[model samples]
Target chain A: MEGGVYLNLPKVAVLTMEGTNNEEEAFQSWRGAGANAEIIHIKKLENKIRKLEEFDAIFFPGGFSAGDYVRAGAIMASRLRATVMRDIENFVDAGKLIMGSCNGFQVLIELGLIPNIGGDYEREAALATNLSNRFEARTVYLKITNNTCPFLRKFRINQIIRLPIAHFEGRFIPANEDLLEEISNNNMIGLKYVDPYGKEVGYPWNPNGSVLNIAGVCSKSGNVLGLMPHPERVFNKYTQSDWPRGNEEDYGQLFFKGAVDYLNEKF
Target chain B: MKINIIVTLKDNVEDAEGQSVLKALHLLGYDEVSNVRTGKVYYIEMKGNDLSKGYEFCDKLLANPVINKCKVERDD
Candidate 1:
C-alpha cells in the first residue's frame, strides 16, 4: 500500500437521479484521483437497495433534478425517501462514507439523511435560495472548519480554497440555535465563506447569507456530509480560476483523497 | 382538518426573491416601495383531530429555520 501509486484506493459509487447532470464529471474526478468509480442512477436503485453495499463510498453529484420544481432538491429527496432510505441507513450504520454536493446536499437533507441523532426521521439543515435572490455562478473562497471528520482529515484549519457554486438556493439554515451551536462546537461546519485572501470574513464573506457564513455542514458522526461547493468541478488545475499564478494546489482533490485514504485504512 | 401555512423569511434574514420583486415594482413606477419580501402560502388538508400534531408537522418537517418561518391557521 505504501509503495503503489494507486494502492488501496476505494471504489466509489456516484449516484444519479433523473435530473442529475454532474455524475459523469464526479465519476471522472474520483477516478482521476485513483479511486475506482462509476455512476449509479437512481432508477436502477428503485427496485433494489442492496446495490449500495458493493461500494466503499457513495456520492450524490450536483444537478437540476426534476427541473428543481417545488424546491431545488425536494423532488430528489422525496424519491430517496420513497426508495433508498433504508439502504442509506444500513450503509451509514456500517460506517461507510456518504457525500452530497450542491443539489445532492439538498437531497440528503430533504431525505433526513444527515443531522439526525437517533430517530428514524429527523430534520437536518435546509438549503434555500441565496440571499441575493438570483442564481449566482461564481468562484467563492471557503474556509475549511477544522474537524476530525473523514471528509476534512487532510484539510487544515482556516484553509482557503476556491470552489464554484451555481444555484438559486444554496443558503444553509439549521433547525435551532442549540443545534447550530452544537454543529459549530463539534466542527461539523465543514466550510464557511472567506475572503479571496483566505481570511474568514462574516456576512458578505457568507456569499449566500447562510447562518454563521456556513457553506456546508455534516452530521455529528461525520460519516455523512452535505455541501454546496462543487469539488468535482475543480479537480484539475486547468479548471481552477487562479491555476497558473496561485500557489494553491487543487483543493477539490482532497475530497477524493481524504475519502480514499479513510477507506484504505478501514480494510 | 384544513390548515393554511404561511412561510416567510425571518426578519434578520435577507429576502432575495422579495427584493427582486420590489425592484420590479419600483421599475413599474411604484416608487413608494421601501421594502419587499416574498413568502409562500400553502393550503394543506390533514387528517387528524389534534392541531398540535399538524403544527408539529409544519414545525419539524415543513419549515426550515435557517431560511424561513412558518405559521399555521385552521381553515375553518
Candidate 2:
C-alpha cells in the first residue's frame, strides 16, 4: 500500500498510429509512476499481438490521427476494428485495464469499446464539437465522480483536480432521455466539470456543453476508462501553468499512479 | 440517384451554437424569429437501383448515434 510501490507494476502498451502524438507523454507518465510502459505503433501491432498478452494494461493516446478525417477518431477506430479491436475486447473481458484519452476516447466511442449512454452494454455516450465550434486549449477543474471505476478508485469523490484539456470535440451528449438516465443511474459518470473552488458550476468552466459536465467514464467492470482530458500533459510539475501557488502537485501524475497501483494490486 | 440527408439535435435538447445564432439574428433586426436551431444537410449521389440500401448507408455509416439524427430523401 506504499506510494509508488509498483511491486507488480503492470506493463502498459500505448497504441500509436499515423498521427497519434501523445504516446510518449503517456509512456513517460506511467514510467515515472513506476510502471513499465512502451509505445507500440499500429503497423507493429500485428506482429505484437502475442506480446500484448503479456501486458496488464493498454492505452490509446490523443492526436490528430489521419488528419481527423471522416470524423475525429473514425478512421483510427475502424482500423483498430480491422486489426486488434477484438484483442482489446478480449483484454477488457479478462479484467485487464484499458484506457483511451482525447482522440483515443473518441475512438472508444466510435468502436463501441466502452459502453454507450444506454442500451445495457452498448450505450453510446455523446462526444461532439465544442459549443464554440473551435478548438479550445485551457486548464479546467474536474470533479471526480463517486464511482466504482478501478481507474479512479484511489481518488476521493468530488475531488477538484486541475488538468489541461485541449480539443475541438470534447462535448459529451447523451442521445435520449433514457440514455441520459441510464448513464446517471449506473454511476458511469466518471468526471465532471467544476469550478476552481471545487464547485460544480456552468459554462466556460465546463469548457464544453457535456451533459452533466461529464469528462470521463468507465465500463461496467471499471476496467475500461475513456476520458477527454489529457493527463499526460500534466504529469510534471513544471507542465502545470500555476504550479506552486496552485499548490497543485500534478493531478495528472496521480492518474497514472492510480492506474499503476490498481494493476499492482490485481497482478 | 440523388439523396438528401438532414441532421438535427433531438427535441428539447439545447443547441448552444443555435442559441448564439439566434442572438445574432435578433441583433440583425430579424425580430420575427422566435426560435432557432442549427442542423446539417448532406447531398449524396448514388448509382444504384435500390433506394433503401442508400438510406441504410446514411443511417449506419454517415451519422453518429450520439449527437446526430439523419433523414434521407431521394429525388426521383
Candidate 3:
C-alpha cells in the first residue's frame, strides 16, 4: 500500500465437502507455495458464510465428492449450478484462476468450466469411465501441450512430467467432433499422455484412451484447467512412485507454485 | 405424476462396457444377442403433470449431453 504494491497476501481457496479427501494435500501444496490457503467446505459457500469472490484463486481437489454416485462429479456440479452458477461465470469472465484435478477435473467438466471453447459455459465434454473397465491407479507420464494456462505456466511446452492418477472415470471425450476441433484450434489442450521417452502411446501408457491422448485441458481464457492426475501426491521426490533417479527435483510443486506466483503478480 | 427416464451413450461414442458385456454374453453361448449397450434409468414421482419441466430437469442434471442422450416418458 505504501509504494503502490499491495502488501496483502493472495488468498487461495481449496474447496471441499463430504467425501472430498484430497483437500488436505491440496491445501498444503498451496500454502507451501507461499499463499494463504484454506480448505473451505461447499456448505460455507452455499450457506452464504463464505463468498467465492473472497479468494484470488480457487482449486477443486481430487476426491470422490458426493460419493461419486450417479456419475463422477455430477452431484457436486449440479448443486453448484443450481445456486452459484452466475458467481462462477463471473469469476471466470474476470480472469480469476480455477483448477480441478482428478475427480475434481470431472467436476470441472460437469460444471462446464474447462474447455469452454465457445465461452457459453456449455457442457461440451465428459470424463467417461476408462476403457480398462476398472480403476487405474499408477504413475503416468504427461507431456505439457500448452503452457498458456496459469496452472502449467511452470512447465515448458512438450515437457514430460510423471504424476500419479487414480480414477475409474478418466477418459476425456468431447461431445462432438466439431467441439474437438474447436478445442485444438483454440489451444485449450493443456496436457497429453506420452511414454517416458516422450513418444505418444496408447493403452497402459495413455491409461484412459482419451481422444488425441489428451490428459488435461483448459478454458479458452486459460484461467480454468482440468486434469485427471494428482499432482499433490508427488510434491517431493520421496513421494513419487519411482523417484530419486532423474534430477530428484520435486516436479509437482511447480504447478502450485505457478498458480501462487501468477495470482501474486496479477492481483 | 410418474416419469421414467432412460439415459444412453450417444450413437457415435464407443460403449466399452457394453462391448465387454456382449463379449461375456457370447462366451455364455448367447449368440442370439447381436449387440449390447449400457444406460441408466431413473423412475421418479413428481408432484405435478408438467412434462416440460421434467424434461428440463433431465436435460440440466439427470444426463450429460456430452456423452449421453436421454428419453423421458410418462410411466403409465
Best by TM-score: 3
lDDT of 2: 0.78
Clashes of 2: 7
TM-score of each: 0.83, 0.83, 0.95
**DockQ rank order:** 3, 1, 2
**Error in Å for residue A163 of model 3:** 0.4
lDDT of 1: 0.79
DockQ (C-alpha based) per candidate is 0.38, 0.33, 0.67
Where model 3 places Cα greater than 4 Å from the true spot, the runs are A1-7
Give a tens-digit lDDT track for model 2, residues B1-76: 8887777766555677788889899999999988888877777787876767655654444556666666767776
In candidate 1, list every pair of residues with a backbone clash: A128-A169, A129-A169, A173-B66
Return the top candidate by lDDT. 3
Kindly report which residue stretches of model 1 are placed more than 4 angstroms away from their true locations once superposed: A1-9, A117-121, A202-204, B1-13, B32-35, B39-76
Question: Which run of 10 residues does model 1 chain A get worst, by summed lDDT?
Answer: A1-10
lDDT of 2 by residue, A1-267 (tens): 454664456789898888888899999988987788888877777666555677889888998877886567877777766677667777877888888899989888877766644323342755777887668888889888954787687688888888888888888876677867776787888898899787777778988777788889787678888999999988987898778676666678877888888887888
What lDDT score is found at residue B27 in candidate 3?
100
- Write model 3 residue lDDT over B19-54, tens digit each, in one string: 889999999999999889899889889898887876
Superior by DockQ: candidate 1 or candidate 2: 1
lDDT (CA) for every model shown?
Answer: 0.79, 0.78, 0.87
lDDT score of residue A263 within candidate 1? 84
